[model samples]
Target: MSAATVSSVPIPSRGWRNDMVAALFWLLTVVGVLMMTGAWFLLALASLEEGTEQPKALAAGTTMAGTTLWLGIVPLVFAHIAGFALCLVATTGRFDRARGVLWAGEAVIGASLIGLAVVLVLSGGQLLYTPPDYVP
Candidate 1:
């Protein structure tokens, strides 16, 4: 092909790439929302059993579950918000393979934050528990 013919051919736009990135971000948002809702449901179930006469082990387990879910709530919300911001930035910037990398990093950060929160909650809950033989 001659240089003039090649020059006349229009270049493909990157709009579709941006749209795909946006769709992926939306999917991530939806998943995050579902996870948050499930955690809330579990927390509610634990609260409902709070008044029941349960064994020490069962009660402690419920308490830890509730605490961990509660701790995770904030981080989950924050992660969603931050992820949305990053998604906007990625889609609007230069179109390249880097958008995929940004999405992966955002996902990892969100997951790690939630995981860390749960671990801290469990550890702190253990410290708050009293032994059967312990006096006031």
Candidate 2:
């Protein structure tokens, strides 16, 4: 509503926010895939401190089930994200407007993946070094 914003550039209209929201959702889905991959990698090679609880051998039967869910979901989510992006691109009708939103969404997706990586590495290292039963 300001002169600078109004005069300098054009804002999107006609379902622009809807398209952007869809893009953001898809971007988040992509990030979810990366997280699942990291988690699955951890599980596939998952080890722990001496006498640490094995993920499969957890006291609860649901632990391994949950792990399998997450691992299996990575690819399914990947497909959804890909399809979502393509849907937006094909249906949006405005290439220039959609492009900016796509770029922004992709940026968010990249940031999310980086954040996941950092958390995984730090927490994994800590878990590897510290045993859960060690409380003093």
lDDT of 1 at 3: 92
User: What's the lDDT for candidate 1?
Assistant: 0.51
Worst 10 residues of 2 by lDDT: 43-52
Give the alpha carbon lDDT tens digit for every residue of 37-130 in model 1.
Answer: 4444444344434323235547567433454345445555565566656655555533554665565566645654564456446555332233
Write candidate 2's Cα lDDT for 1-136 as tens digits: 7778669667756444566656665565566556544543453333332234444457656343343334434543564466446445544444466575575466445644564465567666442223457456
TM-score of each: 0.33, 0.30
- Model 2 error, position 19 (Å): 15
Q: How many Å off is the CA of 88 in candidate 2?
A: 6.0
Candidate lDDT values, in order = 0.51, 0.50
Residue 37 in model 2: lDDT: 47
Worst 10 residues of 1 by lDDT: 125-134
User: What lDDT score goes with residue 72 in model 2?
Assistant: 39
User: In terms of TM-score, how similar is model 2 to the real structure?
Assistant: 0.30
